[model samples]
Target: MKRTVITVDGNGMLSIPSNLQDLWMSEGELVDMLHVTAMKLHAVIRSIYKDGLLTVSEVQQKQETSNGIWQTLY
Candidate 1:
């Protein structure tokens, strides 16, 4: 986990730092995020905009790759 301090914009927008931005991308923009308090390390999380499990396109671009070792070469 990484952390950095950023300024909230006049209208209250939070900009993620450059490096962390690469990890969490959304809607062609980095998501506007908030942290909720939880007892456990991993909390039951939800996206700010969507109601439930996110759509592939809405969350990020989708690409498919196969593990080369999975094939039967014989």
Candidate 2:
């Protein structure tokens, strides 16, 4: 996992790092990527709360399932 520190603006908006922003733009639009990322995070949080400490494989499986469901919906 790659990590970077970012600052939120006075209005609570976040500034995407330039490299990450470029990646998102390549895939689609930044807003759409952010929305999908938020949804994935929500799913991960729920899974963690329900199941407790997960292994890497377990987390990846959960993420794949969650992504599949979201893709089906949207």
Candidate 3:
């Protein structure tokens, strides 16, 4: 697992890191659908926040799991 920080711009936009973009691009034809990928990623992040799954213990448990993206935002 790896960790990195993301920043939201003054206009409230979050830029997906190039490393992540490259990884996703290698996953298949998603290179042509980067916008959709970003949207889905944002939605997943929003859902995690909305669902109150950001607790320390929960985040740790998720990081232990074998699949999916588990992120905690301050």
TM-score per model over all chains = 0.23, 0.24, 0.28
Model 1 sits at a Cα RMSD from the real structure of 12.3
Clashes of each: 0, 0, 0
State the lDDT of candidate 1 residue by residue for 1-74, as single tens digits: 23233545777887657775435432212222333333221223334225556543554433222553321110
Q: Model 3 segments beyond 4 Å from truth?
A: 1-36, 55-74
Kindly give the stretch of ten consecutive residues in candidate 3 with the minimal lDDT sum.
22-31
**Of the pair 1 and 2, which is ahead by lDDT?**
2
**Global Cα lDDT for candidate 3:** 0.45
What digit string (tens of lDDT, one per residue) describes model 2 on residues 27-71?
113235455675565676567757777643443321123245421
Among all candidates shown, the one with the greatest lDDT? 3
Q: How far is candidate 2 from the true structure (C-alpha RMSD, Å)?
A: 14.0
Which of candidates 1 and 3 is the stronger one according to lDDT? 3
lDDT tens per residue, model 3, 1-74: 45343445667676667574222222112323343574575576568868897743443322332466553322
Query: What's the TM for model 3?
Result: 0.28
Where does candidate 2 stray beyond 4 Å?
1-3, 21-74
